[model samples]
Target: MRRPVAVAGAAAALLVALTGCSLGTADAVPGAVRVPTGPAVTPLPIPEVEPSGSAAAVTDPFRRAADGTALPVLERTPGAVFADVTQADLCGPRYSAGVRGERASDAEEAAAAYGVEDSSPYTTDHLVPISLGGSNEVSNLWPQPKEGAFAAAAKDTLEAHLRGLVCQGAVPLETARQALVQDWRAAYDTYTARPLATPSPTAAPTGGDGGVVSGGVCATDGEVVRSPEKQVRLTCRPDAEGVLRWQRRA
Candidate 1:
């Protein structure tokens, strides 16, 4: 959360000129909406890549005890833990494995590698999700339990944030989201059994029409304003320019 939410163009001008909308239901904008469409499905073998240095090698690998050999989950830390079990399985355990779903073939490979009974409990998961721009690589993946892939919401939220950032012209939203997810996964591994405090919601922003607001998303050159009742609106005030935009939070 330290990094600013991709408030594209004129961070300063928008900060002063633009105002936040009240936390209320706005008329839904159909066309103005942009949602994440999963990562590119690439069917390629994960190359043999190590984390850079031996120090990193000793760090989080995100792998579980392979064949009961105590494979740590250090390397698998992605930027975020947004995806649920289903999403992780789609991306595979290693970031590099381009395979999705219950790869019986992968199971066979694991069975051969570990001499396990049927690879039944093992499945792939992406330390970084495709929607977030993570590459399909072995270093970025790890075979987790079928039941442990329940991090879907985290993935969804991160992906949504990335798209909003893209609309604003900040970092390639996809790339940032992927990095963030992978980072979160790594952190989760370190803190898996530890106790952490929950975060409190921040105060909501306030401003705009008696509160009946609409779409106000950011674009490359200017703002695109659409009526809340119809399409998503992007309003670029003379001063605010490209930075200010709004959409009703679901």
Candidate 2:
């Protein structure tokens, strides 16, 4: 049975206030200060996934690289969702601002599962985003690289697009969740008209550019950085010469 939307909305908002984290635009609460908690510890247990093509084979949800490290191994991180989450609760104005609570330990665990020793270049992302009722369970987490053809930023675009569709009643919430869990990149291709080669604006902007200014050279593509003054948000994208520069997000 579906949960009461009013109750769900209240609970979500309380959770966000307690955690100091949000799924909505970072600038949602003006004058809010964010403290940096350093990266997670190294040397965690790496979860093993069943071999592909075996009788009990687990189908991968994301397209993988040659080394099979680009995306999450399905057996280890199949994704999970919250119970009794209704469309009304998700579409509520407070939903995004109220959803977020992925722990540091969970991030470490996800990195270890991916055989990633250094998780600096990755964001421990929710396979099913919290805005869409994704749980904080380890199974719903994956270490998504911040840069690549279908990187974390690109996935963020898909998430936003899917959420918009669901909220607009163009797509059902369950269908959107299933699509994300099945194969996010494919879902992105089907639901969004944007090209994969293009760098999409991230759902949230973070600070700390290491002194990178707007239009300055940045280290990674699809990286978003806010100005030191906390005024303008910039994203790193390749130019005509394939040089990555921090440009104002479109």
Candidate 3:
């Protein structure tokens, strides 16, 4: 009772499945929060709307805080690729752009050489964040320090999107999700390949003792010279004296 057509069709279907599926009105999941339409103020007051009968009722997981809210979580659907949290730069002080991993230290040095203070090495990022159904993941995210950037532009756009849906009455969670998915992909492709405004220079460190000392330098952040020696071996950080002291290696 083996069918070759079934196997071939299944293989063909797999090839077409590149991205994940978004939610829709007819396919709203349980516990989904339906957003309202209107202008979003700083306080971000929640709007009143009737809940869908079949929709699952749970605390609004996508609710953002007034100041620094945690990003929303996007669950993977049956046929879609879930948004990867590992891709986010947790160490950066702002949003997408501040990811030191995204740019090299030499790039920063080049920016400094060009008389640019705190050179911008920001990458486009999701504002509402791709996980929470914010569209144009690329468009939703903008360049700012990954650590310090807020949801200003992204929030404004999201609020407008939500308000429009709410104003029309009976906004479905799935509809919002689809809109966000479409927007993010479009924006992502647009900005991913754009050129940087400031170009990095290819110059080496200027004339100096060349980091390496005669005897050896202490491997630390900030320390003072303990013993007198021509050569010093310096490590990343020493103590808190600002000046690095040298010590012979064993």
In TM-score terms, which candidate is top? 2
Misplaced by over 4 Å in model 3 are 1-124, 127-155, 158-169, 184-250
Give lDDT tens digits, candidate 1, residues 1-250: 6446555435755754554433353556658877877644432222233344435334433342222222324423222322332333323333324434434564354334334455556555444545444444444444544543434333333344443344344444444443443344443333222221211212223235322243233322222345445454544221111123344333
Query: What's the TM-score of each model vs. the native?
Result: 0.28, 0.54, 0.18
For candidate 3, what's the RMSD?
A: 23.2
- True-structure lDDT of candidate 1: 0.38
Question: Top model by lDDT, which number?
Answer: 2
Candidate order by decreasing lDDT: 2, 1, 3
Q: Give the TM-score of candidate 3.
A: 0.18
Choose 1 or 2, whichever is better by lDDT: 2
CA lDDT of every candidate: 0.38, 0.67, 0.32
- Per-residue error for 50 in candidate 1, Å, reads 18
Per-residue error (Å), model 3, residue 99: 20
lDDT per residue for candidate 2 within 88-174, as digits (tens), equals 888775565666688899889887876778878888898888878787788889988898777887888677667766766677888
Sorted on TM-score, highest at the top, how do the candidates line up? 2, 1, 3
